[model samples]
Target: MAGFFSRSVRATADEDAGSDEAPLRPIAASDAVRRVELLDSFEAAGLGWFWATDAQGRLIYLSDNASEKLGWSDGEAIGKPLGELFIPERFDDPNKTQRPLVFLLSARNSISGLNVRLAFTKEEVWWEIAGKPQFDEKGRFTGYRGSARDVTASRESDLNAERVAQFDPLTGLANRERLTTRLTETLTSYRNSKRACALLTLDLDRFKQITDTMGQQGGDELLKQVAARLEQIVDSEGEIGHLGGGKFQIVQPDVDDRGALGELGQRLIQALSQPYSIDGARAIIGASIGVAIAPYDGLDTKELVTAADLALYAAKGGGRGQYRFYSSDLKNSVQERRRVEEDLRDAIANGQISMHYQPVVCAKTYKVQSCEALMRWDHPENGDVPPAVFIPVAEDIGIIREMGEWALNEVCRQAKQWPVELRVAVNVSPMQFAHDDFAQTVRNALTNSGLDAARLELEITENVFLGDIGRAQGMFAELKELGVNLALDDFGSGYSSLSYLRTASFDTIKIDQGFVRGATEEGNNNAAILTAIVGLADALGMETVAEGVEARDELELVTQRGATLVQGFIFARPMPNEDFVDRLANGQQTYEARGPAKYRAARKTVFRRIGLIHEDNRYKVVMRNLSKTGAMIEGLLEVPLGTQVVLDLGGGQLAVATVRRSKGALQGVEFENPLISDGAEGLCTRHRVSPYQIEAAGRPLAALPQDPYSLIMGEQEGAGSPRQFVEVEVGTPKPGTGY
Candidate 1:
């Protein structure tokens, strides 16, 4: 074959030579045959393959070796378009500047080391192909001749290296570098078109406890499970990336609506907080998320990330297992958190903390069976501080163990003074429970207070199981030996694991308030969950307590579900020790279930000034408490019922509400539409005043300013209208006025 091709090439050269040009020399047939044999040996060695295309860009020739490697018979790949046979690699280059293969073929340009995938092959095959355009004597396009080498092996290695650089090895999610690049590109592109994007930053709560308890291998496995859950929840909505050490970031484009973002955040929290089974051991963890939307929270990547971080810090500070949206006040909240952390260290030492008790009653008899001890703080300068605010700070500041020990001792002493039948349940922190001498500490408290071990119940959460199983079981044994009852508090709240019940001996299970709050609502599976939990407890010979039974309907549901004990405001609120003792001494042991007929949305107590817009007038009022569907406000007098008003809650959040109940200076207003979670423990309106609107109102486009209402009002001239009612100062009251 080579001898014949050499003669033909000489003949063609002779034919094309002009009269003035020298004729080309023809090779000897013997040397030509030797060269042909050498070429055949090269093709046989599988070093490369030769291919040719006709003027029409269709394959005319394919090497026999290449055809065989692709599982194709001889001449099978011929007549197909070269572009169709081999497609350009879909894995984009980091620079993202490569031209399409079709364009190069159409332009008949020279291709050098162009990597492509063999589309016709059953197995994945990559080739490094090089070709040059061929022309006829008239300088017209004729065909292309190319050589291709199988690069599947080298390409696989390259891809593996790229994956290591671009993704987290343990979780197989995008790494920080890749996420940063993607975020920068997305923000740049979205900026030009005025599009919106949302970024959620999340960090796992109590992850450190898991890492310390389980080995690093266990932590890695837990992260893989977390990544799987995140992927399932996010699906195709956005991209998720691991930011190292239990932190993750998600970018969802065209999702700036607070309602949708809030829902997504909540789903993530719920999914991550579920129990994780790693290597036959049960683990529970929680997630805190911070969300920031483009053009409102920030306009650039750096600013947006900073905003999201601040929001996440606030969410974790508010108490983990929640999400928060970026707000202007978060900066101040950070400094306030720092101050609170410092103050918390002194709170325990100065005796500013106290324990209050709420009774848990028998569901059938309504007789007080036990009381759960709750921690309360009275800051010297800041006044009363709720546990939700100070407890997380205490945990972070390394004072929770001290505080927990104090509470245990105090509760035991108080319980000794009560009737022998009444038990005292003290909540134990995971940090304190993991201590080497925790059981000993409990024993000492019991002995010192002269409190019977049978009457002392130590409430523990699922987090205690996150550490060494042997240690946790040993602690349980020690506690049991001391004769104290053990109850699983906040059961089904984090990592709801039935396996724990099998492995650890729990005397009781306290149902979380989350399930109880919505158990009676239609379409809520919590009612069924309650029944199942009660049955499970019964099978285990453990008592069940229904927590947070705030309404008569909820009480009825729990009672019907056969819960052993009921606890919540429907019976009574947590009272000071003095009040509790006084009531016990008065023999007020039985209480009637008196509460609202049906469950209502939980309300948050707040004391902040807000702008109340009525018609063209804006009045300053104080929002005393807020819920998803309504709020109680003060400072406006003689406001008629059903009067429409808009409440400016700052940061561009405005809620349209109507006065449902009006009194002398206080009114209860119902929202026209229900509020949504602000990604944290707060409620917010679905939509906010857009920066575009502010720009159109003659201001630069920027984040929400301090006074969005003033921007909307655009400088009112004069005292617009006479004050309809006198403004009463907050914290002051008229002698005869009442709400």
Candidate 2:
């Protein structure tokens, strides 16, 4: 019967259009009989068959199965639109057709009735149908036929699956997948405009701590609340995209300037700052945002996203609850830094890196007391690589520990060869501190080098304690116990106004060069800051040193501001070990004292000269200065305290004096007796020593002094005997004051 109905509709469609069409093929007797049998079988299978008129918009045929399925008799549904049979009038437009259902059937050829839903007398019911329009042999328009099945429960289940995929299970915001779709489309639309957009990437600060302690379910609930708040904030401005697990990316098109972008970042941070009501519990979460402007920081989607991610890292690094604008240089530097990191890893393994020592001078004394060990890599191909370049690279690549250990070993090895009184300061990378055996490693370095622990200074930055504070404290304490001097390097560079002196057990603080570089900027405020830092150091019982002194004025300024130690190019550039020692020795040669001859107040006093004392108690003395009656002596050791000793003032008369004290290699003695009497002529005749005039020989001449002992140890030794050694008494404390 359904087949006959389909054939009649097609023949009528051809006649109405007045188109010549081929006659329908005669139905096979077996097929005609089978059609009836198949329709009956479908009824028994609980499926419904129906037909709607192409023009009349009426249901012309209905199977007995549908009446039974819908609990209605066949006569009740015949001649009426199927929509009217099951659906209420209020839910229908009498003149309107089911265009969506009709289009799906016509275009798709067949559609599932399970996907069809409508209000039926205000009651919901689902039906699945398979329908296709029949056509005459010549392909003229015809009628439709299909099977329908009720599937309201299955339809609802399928819809739930789709909803779960599009929305986040926890927050119910667009999940990463959906966010990616929206982002792609948004970017594509903006692609042709050439206008810049901004991507603000945010991550909750310390979210892991909350998640770790609260359990997964609790963490998820908190995240849901966070997402809801974020949704509310961006609902008016733009779309909110969830990047999953506490990360989000808010994209705004047509950003004006950095200020506006920064403002937006701040707004997001502010919104996240409020306490969230999650699962009946109040929770607080801190957030950091990094904003990257399109076409400025990056032009492409990936580049922009990466820049924003980097900026986000920078924000979190700077300190939580803040924001940083992405810069082109940041991206460029990150790329270049990655390259340098690769170079650093190779350099460490290949021994291409070397250490240079920069002397840290005592500002008042003008003496090279300590040499800071700075790493300098002279790549065979690259030449001199700046410390600034490779240091950061090494730090980033995790090979910093290897490089730092190399630095420590090299510093200690070369430092052992220098004058024993001079100390070596090595900069320890933060990676060194984080090493599980950092303290043990340092101890091993000291033990292996045979260098005194007190003479070895390890420099650390304030950020070294940022991660695992307790571990940092414990490691620092252990290092301190080994007698290594601890200096806080770049003291004011990190989060400042910290009483690190009181909290961290640091023995010294090296004022960042940035402050000192402008210390003498024509009465700049930097002078005050430098002075305050020095005073603070003094108050805390810690020594202060200034770095990056490039000019004489800056040097003088720091000295006057009470900076006891200073390191910079003005004094000496960091040099190789040999050159550093040579520079020190040369500096000691031409430097002169500021006081009048034989007076106590001297600008440049020989603090100490430490060396292995010869077995022979009597040693040669070299007079750095000479007078008729007295001389200032430079020797390897100090005379025993208060011991009167005779000096062969060379070329004759013996002078005797009492040793006052020893300061390193310099000894102070009070003249007990001058071998020569009054006038130069009388002194020369009695002492059998010629009174050489100042200009007569290529050496210093003796002159009689009111203070006779002034010439006691004043004879210059020209023989070069014990050339490197200066003679004086042993066991004097003053000469070794610093040691």
Q: For this target, which candidate reaches the highest lDDT against the unseen true structure?
A: 1
Q: Candidate 1 at 118: error in angstroms?
A: 1.6
lDDT of each: 0.86, 0.62
Q: Tell me each candidate's TM-score.
A: 0.84, 0.47
Candidate 1: stretches off by over 4 Å:
1-55, 60-78, 91-98, 107-113, 129-149, 418-421, 538-541, 592-594, 603-625, 630-648, 654-673, 692-701, 706-739
- Candidate 2 regions exceeding 4 Å error are 1-194, 200-252, 256-292, 295-300, 306-342, 496-499, 517-527, 587-739
Clash totals for all models, in order?
4, 24
Could you list the CA RMSD of all candidates, in the order they appear?
A: 6.0, 29.4
* Candidate 1 lDDT tens digits, 102-187: 77889999988999888877788899988999999999998898889999999899889989999999999999999888888888
Q: How many backbone clashes does candidate 2 have?
A: 24
